[model samples]
Target chain A: MVEIESMVPIAAVVDLVLGIATLSIISRSQGTSANNRIVGCILGWILVFLGLSYIMTSILEFRYGALADFSAVDRDKVGGTFAFTAKNLLLSSAYMLMVLLPFFFPFRLINREWDLWFLLAGVCVACAVFTAMHLMTNFEHFQVENFLFIPGYVVLISMYIRFIITEARDNDERLRKVSVVVGLVLIGIHGETMTYWLSQVLSINDLFFQRQSIQSGLSISAAAWGGINTRLTLGATAMLVLCAGEAWRSFKVGLSPFGVLTFIIFIIGFVAGLADLAVLDVVRSCYETQCEAFPVAYTIWYDFTSEALVYLYTPILFMFILLHYDIVDTKREENRWLIRIIVILMLLIVSSTILELIQSFLPIPDMISSAALAIVVGIFIGWEERIVKSLIDDSASIQETVPDFALPEIEHDFASPRLFNLVFGGVTAFILIVSLLFTGLGVLG
Target chain B: MSSDDTITSRSLLVTRESRVPTAVALLVTVVMMTVTMVDFVGDLRATDTFTSNTPDWNLTFDVQNYTMQAVETLQDDETRNLEFDMAEVIIPEGYSLGLIDVTITSEEEEGISVQCDSVAGDLIENGLTAQWNSPMSNLSGQDSSCQPIELSLQVYPDFDGRSITVSAVNEYQAMQHWLQDGWGQGVLSVDLELDVNSPLGFDPIGQDTDEEITVDVTVIMFKANISLVE
Candidate 1:
């Protein structure tokens, strides 16, 4: 019997390869501007850090049969290795970075506006301190680090939204639509984060989970059909369809073969993600009963389907960026055969997803479904490579133009020192009041 | 006409014909909004009367290495009741005891049967049995091969008694007088469980798996009064 836990390392290895490929493509591409290069590099590093963390966690979990913190485990049982400590540090750092990087995107780190830069720096420091506290603490429950993390997430997302609005304000009709679509996608990604924050502030986590009837109803509703990921997929699919429509409207032409292939793969992935959510609902309903008899296979199927969508998402985004930027040299007819191969490959992947979904309810050997899925994924990586290479080549020959949409140059106000002092004073006063309130409650209780 | 003029005319045509599509989109949006609102309202109604039951008070006792002894006052032929002062639990005022459960666990190699008899107050003979072999049952004979047994006793609040005394007898040797000495050497742990009901009988609203409330009945052994309210 294949242990579901063993698949963690395999998935981690795949993630690491994808991360490395993304970074290498970005670094080697001569067509990307310095700003795009910086953004791409940061995104690549985010994936790399996440992948490494997963690898470390999987290793430790496989050895110990559970993911235990360094302080929680017996060193003798784990061969006195420092793997747990390293895993904690890596994963915590990755989480902090993931929360912080969006604010720094489009090169906000070098902004001449001192106030914005100062705020960003302060947020970074807070994140670092909270991450350190999370690492050092042995008590895993009732953490105050959550206070900092949630606020940091909120601030970063707010900053990104502000950036998008500023971009849209100065852009043409087409670019504005693009910005709006991207904004919707970003909101979908962070919707769950905001919900968690609201739950924490209201102390409603228990109440929220206890509404089984509501959850069941939501499981069937279109708005929350597949839970949060369904919403995400909806936003992403909308973006892709809008982009395709825009391409058609502007160029008065049909999609290139590459575009068609990418679209097909994305739709298959979105459907598969939705199907996985339904499978999860089924598994959860029967988890303690029917699924208990075949725990490993059910768990592996759930993880595989879920992770497949996540893996597909990054490549889909890459394809979307290519389409939105009009980087594909469709006029070149040399790669027609390659496109045909890609189309065939994508069709196979779609068939595999359908097969896997059907097999999810069947009594067939899980290995057959797993092998089919793995083969397609292996082919997908190579296909992604060819597409990225073609886009890079096309982009190199493209000349820079005064874009119909241009970002507005931001000027920092030499804000009167007195106003700055007043603002700082108010912030300090608020912090003091909050601290006093907490201290008073502690003392009285 | 020139190509640029043709393109401009086409764009105008498309714009003029866009009204139907725009209205259709608007209609779809409204329908989606209505569905979401209806679902939201339904969920609110479902959870409106939902409330979790929280026990007003709970008392748990952990008795370790309790060695059973034959009553020396009685002759072996008369009765072989192996007795120990399992635990003495006190329920605070304003809260009445609604349930009492006892679990006896042992790790001895030999199998034994147990029965409980009330010395004072009322303990309803609600026969509820729970048996589970220890994970180490497959190990050597020296290893703990015993199973856990649970006894649930219902108590009435009308009894108005704050205290209760119960004695556990080894049924296996109680019937065989020849094994009285062997049964005396048996040691087991006991857990005394009590649930106190609310005065108004209003169940608490939600269950928090994170923070479980447990009251130590062993504190009663020191004659200390404890009341745990959740």
Candidate 2:
């Protein structure tokens, strides 16, 4: 069986391109409403953070091969390497942005002038604290920052349920738009975990971790293991809640595409849970006997669901939110061509990656697959205008849609895209410098 | 109603319009967070005290051998050779071929006047996936006085012994690394030559003219079994 290729490269390239494209759009929309501008900047920066993190991850994978294929000990053995350390730090930085994103987007919950400072400070403090803790503990406490996701999860989930309830109560289609945005944000953040919902609920995920620990010869501290379980529990709970929320909304106000997306994810989780059960022996092989290779089919299942969600679909989802919701001022005439280019470019790239993945498993001859790719490319090119127009035509900013629900703008002179770029840009440089220094001095690894 | 009381996103959770969903959200988040924090804290405490009960892994090696032997008759001044096709050696599941040994023997009874003719065995490394020139490998063994000459080669690198106890394994253990195909493979040849040193260096009768030679080859295969040290 062909091995599943690494998705870090795909995630890296997609996030970087989409992020830069988004920021460029935001930079040009200087006259937009302050709330939308801030939201766009935050989303853009989140993507950039994720992009840079994935880039570091790609570098690490290139240097030491896939982390999943490595035993835990070997994972740590390479963990001390420059790319590995940089990758984790960069990821933690991305997570910090993700954690703060909910408060800004869909609706700026923390709308005061100083709330902006709090966010900047949160990112800064999180960066310093996490960097110190990881180094002090030799990266053992890296996952500890998972606790930080709780606030974001709580805000997103709460906003989602609240808005959906209001939307149904008022029969206001505008409010449904808000709910959909919140749901998309929820899925974007917790999608991978959501796919493991069944396994997490059944605690089969714990067994898998146990097997990994035993095989890697690494005994994680209770704290670290707890961190892992915490994240899993959050994902599991979020999945259940999402499935419930989506089903209720669909029943109340005919199904939306977002509802269908949630159900599909729910189904994937159900199947994934069964698959995890089917391979219980393989997962427990290390604890009971010796470790065994997971069946190729099981691995392929993971590749399509969890791996694809994280590496491919999440960016697409974000792009949808950006364009569909008019987060980046997509209506402006000058910006139309660029948005169209990004939409088509992202679609093409994601399509090519999926085709490559299918070709890896299916017995399609190279010529046939190439032709299939050509067909996809042709179809996308033919429908490029329609796709871009569909995304841009009905776009309305959250500020414009649910004005009654919006909190009054607390600051007139709000932060600009430049300030965020400058701050996050500095954070990136700092991370790279620290990584280089620690790696050079051999303080890490 | 009050300009100063316009609820921030943080405060809107408990506001009149959203209190119910906010409470439910808080409750769900709280329950999961509490359960997780407890588990994490307990684990953290266990680790900080240096009393972590991380399970000990015990790897027991099940040692077994795969052997092939051929007996040949060599007349005086006869050079007889036997090629042992190592491919015939079947490795059981989870077992790896670790060491290969070739023993060449010549029969020299006390009454026989054929004073153990110079017997030599050469384990020619035709195409074997083994450490052919290992210091432990006696690939070329010669016994002038008819002692069973032995030729040894390690099938895989650093294959010390089949019956080993690996107290710990660090990632995709040597079990996966050491288990490879074509180990101790290829055609192993043992060359035997007999020169009867009769009482006067002459054999009137052909009694001392012919000798029976035994070429014995053994392949040691090993499998690993793991148990918790606790």
Candidate 3:
């Protein structure tokens, strides 16, 4: 059982890589807009950050030395050690943000279909509910609370698969459908990572069992890798796919001369990273005795010039580009406020990314997951219709650029969201306030 | 539809939804009351099995020194027979082990030594009876009768904690058969009723009968021997 369980994270890593490649191929074949492609890129880097975070934190610290401030005591702690005390808390919060960030796409974008939105909402809710169970599990009588998370796995997996099968059909905009499918795969893998997190918490005592103790460490590493790697890989691939597709489509439609070159550069950079990862695996395995060699090679080839390595500056670079794009395009100005909101939401996404980086190994509370869900709901209540219509319009633009293609017919038929937005905003604000009271007042969180 | 009419309809719908909790509460109350009544009826017919009105019969233990040693050893061995001195055994009711301790001072010159040894378990021919051998005769002076002795058996039962009772007992009638014709004739009979209750300090014979005897038998102590019911 120990040896088998030790292979779980390896399997998860393989699945994550496959899932990312699938997204890349699907996006390349189907095509998507520039914005969705950008979101996909952000998500891809986030996953890589998650995977690396898991690896770094897994390096056990066994050193104990005299402290300058307290000479009598040694500070080093044994076993699975973290660079920072709050690493798990941060990673958990990041995974939660990933689970929720999709709900913010404006109404025009989501107008293509409601199932995708519902599935995303359902996954967010499941994440939040599981998070609540995780928090409640801190109670001494943890059985019932821990048991609640099992059902969440079923719900999330089923929802993701449902979203995948339904969106796989060749009907509407293939790029959007591919984005949704990739998103589902990422979500599915992330959800599985959550199952592993819950298993760790529930099986902590079981570690003493001969079979479990040996596998526990490896299982922890694998789960963490599965979680963060899938997010980063799939997230980055989707972004590159959507962005390259956008630039290529624009070029095909006679938009720009340099669009094809930009598209090729993005694809080559992505493929190069994939190749480097494969090479890194071989070298790291062979030089297992020389610990510093892999890190040195990784820093040079994989970490330094990696396409998704820009995620280190993701929070800043993505916003700068978005704001810059808004200036160059007039229609982007009409949606400039929405774009800024996206930037803020992306900032929150980055927070989850940072959290995920730390979460690579440990867990944070479910409250953070809840906050992310509230943000998602607020996004949906605020912008689903606009996002859907924009995607649909972008799709229609492929066939013709006539006046009738200006907007879809049901834009007017969709219910006015003023009431919904107000309610959603009110509820979100209330929840935020309550969370603040709980955490800040030292009552509960 | 007019704005006022729409507002009125919305208010009515709100009122209807609000009544749901109240309806649920009422249903819960009715169900709870019915459950209580059913439980109350069920408890009324439950039977009482642990109490009874009949008095209990008890057997007390007392032995001479030699018998006490043998019985104490037999207590540990479940299959061993507890040997006892049959001549020394004294049952407290009408039955006794052997001839009662009797003294007869003859007022004649000639003295006859009469001994009876027929009080053995194997000599009993029927329930509660023992055939006897004695130098005596019937009222017609036939050879089938034996000389009878006017012997009185004193019975003392140990009752501790009011644990023993002899209900519907006739101690006088049980003792009056000592002067039957075959037993003794032309002998002055002085019936001495003995009542000995050591623990309770209540003597039924001493309270009922006014007969006085020259010798007195006092019960010195009473102790209980308790065992598990099985």
The candidate maximizing lDDT is 2
Which candidate number would show the highest DockQ if scored against the true structure?
Answer: 2
CAPRI tier for the interface of model 1: incorrect
- Provide the TM-score of chain B versus the true chain B for each model in turn: 0.22, 0.74, 0.21
Candidate 1: segments with Cα more than 4 A from true spot: A1-7, A25-32, A67-88, A104-110, A113-124, A139-173, A180-361, A366-404, A408-445, B1-230
lDDT of 3 by residue, A1-445 (tens): 0110111122223223422432342234223343333334334333433443333233322132211110111112312122221223223433443443333221112334453335335534643553354334321121122222222322222222222222223222322332233233332333222222222222221211111112121122222222323333233333333343345345444333233433443554554445444444333321121112233333333322231233333333323322322211213334444443444444454444444333333354557655765676577547655653343233322113222211232222222223223332343343334334434544331
How well is each residue in A1-445 modelled by candidate 1, as lDDT tens digits?
2222333454355445544554555434554443444344444444555566566557667767553211123223432234444444444444444444434332233334553445434534654564444333321211232222333333333332332333333432232333332333333233222212222222222223223322221122222321322222223323333334334433543344433533444444445444434444343332111211224443454344434444333334433343233233223344334433433443454456455545655655888778877777677666765754464444421113223222332444332223323433343343334334433444211
Model 2 stretches astray by more than 4 angstroms: A1-4, A69-77, A211-219, A287-290, B1-166, B169-230
Each candidate structure's count of clashing pairs: 0, 3, 38
Candidate 3 lDDT by residue in tens digits, B66-115: 11111111111122222222334333433322222232111111112121
DockQ by candidate, in order? 0.03, 0.18, 0.00
iRMSD value for model 2: 5.8
Candidate lDDT (C-alpha), each: 0.35, 0.76, 0.29
Comparing 1 and 3 on TM-score, the stronger one: 1
C-alpha displacement of A275 in model 2, angstroms? 1.5
The C-alpha local distance difference test score for the whole of candidate 1 amounts to 0.35
Single out the weakest 10-residue window by summed lDDT for candidate 2 chain B. Answer: B46-55
Ranking by lDDT: 2, 1, 3
